[model samples]
Target: MNILGLIVEYNPFHNGHLYHLTKSRQTTNATHTVAIMSGNFLQRGEPALFDKYTRAEIAIKNGVDLVIELPTMFACQSAEFFAHGAITTLNSLNCIDSICFGSEEGNVDILYTISKILVNEPDEFKASLRKYLDEGMLYPTARSLALFDYINKFNLLDISKEKLLSILNSSNNILGLEYMKCLLKLKSNIKPFTISRVSASYNSENIDSNICSATAIRKSLKDYNNLSLIKNVVPSPTYDILENKLINNFEPMFDDKYFDLIKSIVIRENNLLDKYFDVNEGIENKIYQNVFTSSTLNDLQLSVKSKRYTLTKIKRTLNNILLGITKEDMNIVKDITSIPYVRILAFNDKGREIIKAIKNNSDINIINKFSKTSFSMNDKVFKTLIDYDIKTSNMYNLVYYKNNQHLLKGPMDYYISPFYVKNMCFKK
Candidate 1:
């Protein structure tokens, strides 16, 4: 059976996502489509609009056969680490034939070329990068300048600086390059495919087209309780779910809402800031000092932002602090070089077949629920990794308490079951 693998956030499934899903299945002509999706938190260093189980259920109801959770630790990281962890998980499945992702350029050839440069890191490019870094340029700007210099000097490809800049500026293209780099670095067998994004740009915050950016949809949802305009950009099924969620006051989790809790965590870890993952270059002190007076996540980020650190970077670091994901924890998992387990969020009948295939064909543990798992892993290591996921879920569930009955009592990790969507209907 040809199985297509996809990486998704689906913060709230929309028309753009639906198009990508439909095209992915058609392009691969695959029997099954499996998605590795972000859990509660997303790559953008924010909690998802809806919970993971709800999002996964929507995915399966639309087209995805199975949805597996990307560990929160990796999901809320930078592009490189996020791609590395996601690609690693997809590769671990051992049955996927291809991995399809959406890109602004949709040119796998160019993406692959960029990936080669990133993977190989030619001497001249590295020197240029170092020179720009020494000049105190932000990492992203410095890397872009370095690549521009090296590419032009060597005449690597028949491309222009402006075109390259456009490519780099496109967030989807950047992620597509990272995905390609991961596959090349790992020498994995799964083929990579790209689908071009249409209409709205990645960061666009207004819905002006049928295929609108998720950012736009989210912003609209928050500013206006009405879904009339949003209905244009998302599938009817997704729209219905979103409408219901809005009616119940279950949405738009602005990061600043957890400011008090995040501040407490940051202040508590002041002396031990070095322990937190991604709080490098003495950024811990900045966060520690800022946490004292910063009232909101936005305030903290603005107070801590600098030439070297973007707001997104600061937010991610703060998120790590909130989850208590230490550098030591990251190192422990990195040392093992493999995820301890894969958690299934939602699936259909086709997904049941895929699970059976996984059991018979792969060695990695598949967790439908905590109690149902029977895998032999070092107790300490297993707990360490799973703790981050549980904590992230509990934190996200806190935001959805109005709609989520299970979370009202306590954390919903154990009580939550793998959602099953049958006949395009969502089931808890």
Candidate 2:
């Protein structure tokens, strides 16, 4: 069973993602591909353009064999934890032999260099990094400058090194490298490989030249006529699945509602507001000041803006606070001892075989039902208030959609791919 693992967030699947999935299959020579995808919120702090299930549908239609949702707890985390969660999930599957990722450089040695800098900061490098930080530079800028200084100390910034550093700054390679580093640190036996991504910018916010980022896709969703822009970028089947959804009343998440809840949580934590993740450097005071002054979420963020921190990072920190996670929670998550719980959102006949392999496996939690899901929401409320020093949100009415799994073993999985289903090709 030569299975390959992919860490993905097909927030809205596109042609670039399809390309990566295809390349992953060929590179690993694997019969099955497993995707550990993000759920609800993305790392960028916004709800996904569509829902995770829809994205998984796109993936399964395109090339992925099995789709498992990465739990919300780990999905909206920093890259280190995100990668850790994904690697842990893949390793638990027991049959996964290779991990394929898209990289800007695709050279293991170069990524290892940056990984060393992050994990093993030498004295000169630390001093250089500190000097840059003291100058009030943003973390990325400071790290870039310090890295250059440190590399120059040893006359190592040759053209190739410079190119690799530039690649490290590119979002794809940074994530790809982090995946490798996580696998390395775990001491897992899975083989790792990279496939260079093509024709898509990680943060591009507009459709151009048949390539568009999820940001671009989401921004254009309301424009009906422009939905074709996405149609051209995803696999024909995946694209078809999206046409009706491109501009429908189906709301995946109520961001405004989440914001109001966040504000309430902030206001109620008057005394312990300093304990949340990213609530440092006087950010807690800003949260307090803004909670009283601003009525909207964006307004509160504006009140706390600093040159050193990006607004997105600030939003993520706020989310961490809302979730009642602190540096301590993060520390504990790093040492979690459970296997990844795989939940199928959509799949093909090939995916069935993958499940068959895990059916009797005694090593990990191959869960198909939700009642048996660990980490209950009820327990989190207690943990949040007691451990993370934060107040809990009111257990108001919540939308809990039962998953649609008609495709599990029916014709949808056997024949109708994502696009075909969207196109009505398999309709009776």
Candidate 3:
């Protein structure tokens, strides 16, 4: 009954992901592992390298017992919201014992202390954060500076300022911190564990070793068609799935397709940009003007990015526009019910047991099927949230078709059943 939960994108499950998966089980003595992964879109405002079902199947083949879909509403959001959604889903499962994540620092104690500070923001801390925001710094940078300033001014913890800075500086550690923050905010009993990342640098495109970052793997796939270079870096199952897609002329989703879609949306609805989620502070005008001139996704992102908003932020906002996710949608989801439904993507036998346990104990609704009639008895929020997931899948499939006209696999979310893997390791 010792189930370990992980929140992941698995955007083409690589060697580094495998290492973390094995280490997580070993360290926690977990009998089962559950992964709540992003649907087609990712937090970085890009579509996954492969479809969600393929990624979920790979996760099950590797070692994970269960795979659940983190809805597109949260998947394509900022780090805090993404962490909040994943943690909330795992908590709703009512079966997970602990949640483990990879961090650059690999120190849960430091992360825990910082999480407390975030959850229990004192007056001085709030003032410092407000000061930084007034100074025109972006929220992420401003928050980091504010934390650094507050911790030193009040001697918050025993950790040094330099050490604290390093924790915030690392991307994985920042995510790990957010996970801890959410867990504490929810007052959940699930323990937190951090596994040191062994991959190449977070976003480094240079692949010199067997383990490389997902960013680098995607770059390699786009820049070179040679699958041999990454064979050693990804597990056998991952390699097979990716190779099959590539061989079938169904390449990874390129950003240009998404950018073109966004461009069309922005140009046609230029006056309605403010209605899109995260397209505030006059960013819509920048997007509208730049979409006409930019030829590539990178060009559009760079043109719209400024000190106030990072490139990733701009891309995430654009993703919201493409999906027609408005600020009102986010507010309703967040303020009313953060997680409305728990949806299964892929599972094995052990996962089935977990699902049964969840069904018996969980307070949230469970979704194993994706048809319109499936929501006939559900709440309006469930329909609203699930609709976003459906739209994301439809859009992802459209982009897939644009990339591979001949290898068209029709949208499977609505018609296909949750992927079930026969027990390959257990012989009866």
Candidate 4:
């Protein structure tokens, strides 16, 4: 089945995503589309606007045939680690033929060249990069300068301002390149595909006429009640479902129930703050400083904001705060490359068949109920994840004020229940 794979958060399944899914299939002969998704939390470290099951359902409705989670440990961290986790998951799947992603610059050779430079790491390259950073340039600016300098000297890496601007201007494209770097490192069977993004900006805060950014959409959803903009832009099925969900007294709930827990972890145990994944360079101190003075998540972020600390970095920082992810934990995460197993959230007939096929001839454990598993490592991790799920749902159901559901409402129940499944009408 020439399977195609995508690593996505789908936060709310916007138009740009729909385009990417359609283009992914057009670029591959893959019979099935598989996505390794982020769970409740996302990479930049913020709570997903919608939960994982909802996001996965949206992906399935839009195009994906099967959805497996990119575990919370990796899903909510820095790009390099996130890429390592994602690409490793793709490699472990053991069947994906190609991995498709959206990039601002669609030049495969150029991206590959840049990927090689990042990996091979010539001695002088690090020196030059260090020198640039010492001069107070942000990491992105320093990295870009280093690449441009190398390209201009050899006239090979393609340093044209237009070309550089094409990819470096957006954070998403930066992460996309990291994915390429990680893929090359793994040297897996999955071929790479990059589709140039069209008609949408990643962080634009305004809803464009027809092509709106997810950031803008998220802000609008939080700030306004009229979703005319969303109604006009999101795919019909998504639009209908989202509308029903919100209109039926369902307030848009975010994953913030453990806000105090994060604060407590950050402030109570100074050393524990050092445990979060990617907590480095005195960031634990930053959390210590912020947690003491802040009362809300927004305030905590504001207290910690600085030039070297990008918002995305802050997001990940907060994530580490909550997860207690430490640098040592990262070391533990790095040694494990292959995905432990494929964690299914929801599926239809095609998805069912795929599961059946895997069961008939698979080697790895296929966990239908991560809640029930006793696979030592998975048992512990899955327990914490589902706990978070039930907590978030319980909290969200309250923010809208319909009922006060218990935080740990499900566990022998629908705590991690696959939200919904839409039967696809793929051409026979």
Candidate 5:
């Protein structure tokens, strides 16, 4: 009954993901695996290449037994919040034995060490962090410098500054660190494991190898408009499903698709743009000022970008505006210790058993079929979270199925059932 948990976006299931999945299961010898996946929007502040349901189906088909949607509120957020939501969801399951992630630095011990320091934030570290922040460096860059300064001054680990910086600067490693930090923050008992990422880096656009990054795969699709170009990098099911969708005229979404909508919102809500989450420190002014001249999402982001705010951060803010996720909404759930519900996206036969186990072992609600009256309407936190999830799904559907009006039914979440894969066979 050992269950392994994975946190993933799986924008398009690829060979790298397949390898990580196989190795993680082998390493843990788990009987069941569950993944907490991002929905339509991803942490990188972009809509997924394919929607969540398609991605979840591909995940189950590939190997994972079950896939649960990470709430939209957390899906399009920073690493800390994203990890917090994911780890908390898995923790709520109450049956997970271990959680595995792939990282540039494969050593869990090293990542754990860094996570502890970050979670504790000692006096010296905090002082160093403040100093770097005061210097107007990006948060990630400042944190990296502060971490190195604190670690070097105290002679914490026998690692060079260059090596530590390399570890801190990597995308996967940053996520891995946040995962560990969240695990510690929750005092969860699930063991953590990490496997070294092979070949291409996280943001690498080179597709020379079979195990290239998801970025590379997406780049190939964007450049050539052909799935066959990435045939070598992704699994068979990924290729088949994506190809089928394309053949049926299902256009994959990119960030730019919502540029006009975002610009309009920025203009209409110019005075009160600060109400949205992460639209702080007068960044709203920059966004509003640029909206009139910015032609694309990229142009707006670049116009709003500064040393203090990264492109990704600006994109996340823009998405928050589009989703109408207000800071007040975040405040209402600030003290929410656990996820209100576990929403299943896709599952296999083995996943049914896991669901039963969850029902027996945990008290959290499991949402297999969403309806307006399924949960308590009196609960403000619950309402807020569920409303955002439904709203984001509708918005994603609006853009995704705009060309095909027939598919744009009202509130897709209420009618959609968790995708089921009968007689599932694990891919080798």
Candidate 6:
């Protein structure tokens, strides 16, 4: 019963994901696989192309046995928090053998070394990091430079500064480092494995091959409004699900979809924007100032983006505001040692077995149904986390089903059940 865990945001399952899934299982020689995936919103603070259930179903159809929702509070956050939520959730399962991730630098040893330095945070590294921050460098930029500085100054490893910078600069490498960092912090038994990312880069915008980035796929869909344009890049099941959504006129959701709503909220909460998570250091003022002049979400984000605030951070802040997630809410959950519950999104026959394994081996709560009675209402932290998941799902559904207003009668999360696939056969 070797179970492999993966942290993912399979916004739309594609060929690259298929390769990683197959290779990861082969590398770990695992009997089953579980994925902790982002819900309605993604880390980049954009709405998913399709809803969570649809994406989860595609994951099952492709290869993964079970898909658990990475709670909204963590899904739409920075790399550290996102990795913390995902790594902690997998650890809580208490049955995972190893966790696998895809990265440009496929060497686990190098990633592990970087993670150790980050987790330990030596005095010299801290001093250098602070120096960079004080110099007005963006946090990510500062951190990367600081890492290079610390390693170069101490001659920690035999690696060159150029090689180290290259590793830190790659998005997947950075994320993989975060995963290892969390694993070390928890002292979890789950071993980490990495596979080299093939073909397109993480943010590549053009479809050059069958394994192009999800960004390229989404860009094609957004630009052409045609599913066939991405038919070659994604697995057949993914294409089918996407085509179905297109046929139903439930066009893929994007950040721009919420522009009007965001604008309205910014206006209504102008003075109150400081209450939202990530809306600190007078960023609320920039948002309020930009909302009136910006016609689209991208425009507003660009307007608000500065040396201190990256585009992704700005977007996350706006999303936090839209979702009504407060800094206080983040503060409450910040110290939570483990995820309060594991919410199943979709699963197959093997998934059921995994669930049973979790129940027998772990005390973590398993949420298959979204009813109020399933969780402890008395637990404020649990309530806060679960409420955000429910709120984000309902919000996504409201926008997704905008054309079919009749479907918005009640909260969709309560009515939706974790999708079940009878057969566990992986589709090639």
Relative to the true structure, how large is the alpha-carbon lDDT of every model?
0.83, 0.66, 0.84, 0.71, 0.88, 0.90
Error of 5 at 8 (Å): 0.6
Model 5 clashing residue pairs (backbone): none
Better of 3 and 5 by TM-score: 5
Task: Report the lDDT tens digits of candidate 3 across residue range 208-287.
Answer: 89998988888887888677778988999989988887777776876666777888898899988899888889989888
Per-residue lDDT tens digits for candidate 2, residues 30-66, read: 8777788876566766556566657777787777778
| Candidate 4 positional error at 91, Å | 1.1
What is the number of residue pairs that collide in model 2? 2
Compute each candidate's TM-score over C-alphas: 0.91, 0.77, 0.93, 0.85, 0.94, 0.95
Which of the two candidates, 1 or 6, achieves a greater TM-score against the reference?
Answer: 6
Better of 3 and 6 by lDDT: 6
Maximum-lDDT candidate: 6
- Model 5, residue 253: distance off in Å is 0.6
* Residue 314 displacement (Å), model 6: 1.1
Give residue 52's lDDT in candidate 6 (0 to 100).
91
Better of 1 and 3 by TM-score: 3
RMSD of candidate 5 to the true fold?
A: 2.1
Range of the 10 consecutive residues with the lowest summed lDDT in candidate 4: 404-413
In model 4, what is the error at residue 67, expressed in angstroms?
A: 0.9
Candidate with the greatest TM-score versus the true structure: 6
Give me the runs in candidate 2 sitting further than 4 Å from their true place.
Answer: 116-161, 222-229, 244-248, 252-257, 292-295, 326-328, 337-340, 359-362, 373-428
Clash pairs, candidate 3, are none
How many pairs in model 4 have backbone atoms within 3 A of each other, for residues 3 or more apart or on separate chains, i.e. clashes?
A: 6
Clash total of candidate 5: 0
Which candidate would rank higher by lDDT, 4 or 5? 5
Worst 10 residues of 2 by lDDT: 388-397
Clashes of each: 0, 2, 0, 6, 0, 0
